[model samples]
Target: MSLKPGNIVEGKVVNITKFGAFVEVEGKIGLLHISEISNSYVKDVSEYLKENDIVKVKIVSIGEDGKISLSIKQANLEEQKKSCKPEEVDWNSKKRKTNSIDFEDTLSKFLKESEEKFKDLKNYKNLKNGTYAKKKNR
Candidate 1:
């Protein structure tokens, strides 16, 4: 079978190099780059996978030189998809506003916080400049 870009397939690790692993899938050999091997950190390919290991991989890209780039990460991501349903995202939900909420109170709260931060900064600067002195008890 002719392998195409973006097709998920099963492959065996025929060879492993420092840069990547050679996977033979359905009589078609592809390069599984180190970057595409796993979702999490993989310090060494041998530690994560070994020769003759069977793994499901996704065809991420195809170069003009007929180099098939496979991704184990993509395959793992596909597996994760099977466990969850696609969430119905309501884009219009962002536009919804409650009438009971007062905007002025939020604004005043933000302004009050800003004033307090500014006062603290001013006090720090004055202290650094030796303009602040301890008051003497009368």
Candidate 2:
């Protein structure tokens, strides 16, 4: 069967390399790149996939030379959207409101928070080192 972009297909992983994995789909071999493995950072491809594992992948591109690029992340995303209920609010659909604060007010708020954090750190260090009781007496 011919593969096209955005087509979801099931493939069995035949080989794996540091860069990507080769999957066999309908008697054809396709490359599932490591970066396309997941939406999240994939430090190790083997950790997420292995040889002989069947995976559902979306065909991202098919080159003139017949190099097929597949994405498991895209397929998973499509499946998740189909199975999950639509979100009530799409936060990304609307532009975020930026509350404009005066520079003076912003600086003062930052300074106040920083002072409180510094005091907490100092108190933590004193307590850890058994110096808090000494300071309390003074």
Candidate 3:
């Protein structure tokens, strides 16, 4: 079958890299990017696939430069992914406003904590170097 977007096809893993694997389908080589290799976080591609292994992949996209992008996860998803579409969101909802406020507050809190830690680190360094004199009772 001709390689097209969303088309599930069988391809041979021609090469494997730290980032991803190259699969040859229909006499054309396509890059199965690391992100597209699996649904979960993949630390190593070799754990899931090996060179010359035949894999079922979904054609993700074909670039204007003749580059083909393939996805094994999408091939597995197929009908399930369509049925599990994310619920529609109201962009102007009150929840979004509250979330933004919460984010800003969290960021300020993080910055304050960071500054306090840095101050303590500086003081500790100074004390270790004998730059800070001990307070004597008056």
Candidate 4:
């Protein structure tokens, strides 16, 4: 089968180096870089692959010089993403609950609280500056 980008193919690990393992896929040998080996840190390439270990890898890219870059971690991740189903959100399903409390009553309470807080702040500011503002007899 013809190898292309995003193609998950089974290949044989013919050689393993400190950096990565070279695998033969469809008679074409490509470099599976150490970074592409796994999602976690790979201290040694030999620990993952033997002299003749079959591995499934994703074709990352192909250079003009026929250099093919492969990835094992990406292959695993892509498979995981494929298996996962996206959650369908029902935007209009949940109806908004109507409040029984009167709007005017709530507004009046908020306004009264705000005015009291403002008056207290003003009194505090005047006291700090050593000046007392005369309160109007309401």
2 or 3, greater by lDDT: 2
| Global local distance difference test of model 3 | 0.90
Question: What are the per-residue Cα lDDT tens digits for candidate 1 across 1-138?
Answer: 568877788999999998889998888789998888877777798887899999999988888987788999998898788888988998777564767567899899999999999999999998866643444322
**Clash statistics: count for each candidate:** 0, 0, 0, 0
Q: What TM-score, computed on C-alpha atoms, does each candidate reach?
A: 0.61, 0.61, 0.57, 0.63
Off by over 4 Å in 4: 87-138
Better of 1 and 3 by TM-score: 1
For each candidate in the order shown, give its overall lDDT on alpha carbons.
0.86, 0.91, 0.90, 0.91
Off by over 4 Å in 1: 86-138
- Per-residue error for 75 in candidate 3, Å, reads 0.6
Which stretch of 10 consecutive residues in model 3 shows the poorest summed lDDT? 129-138
134 Cα displacement, candidate 4 (Å): 37
- The candidate that achieves the highest TM-score relative to the unseen native structure: 4
Model 4, 64-117: lDDT tens digits are 999999999999998999899999988979665687667899999999999999
Cα TM-score of candidate 1: 0.61
Regarding lDDT, does 1 or 2 come out ahead? 2
lDDT of 3 at 35: 92
TM-score: model 2 vs. ground truth: 0.61
- Candidate 4 structure, TM-score to reference: 0.63
lDDT of 1 at 95: 69
Ten contiguous residues minimizing lDDT sum, candidate 4:
129-138
Q: Where in model 3 is the C-alpha error above 4 Å?
A: 79-138
Query: For model 1, which pairs clash?
Result: none
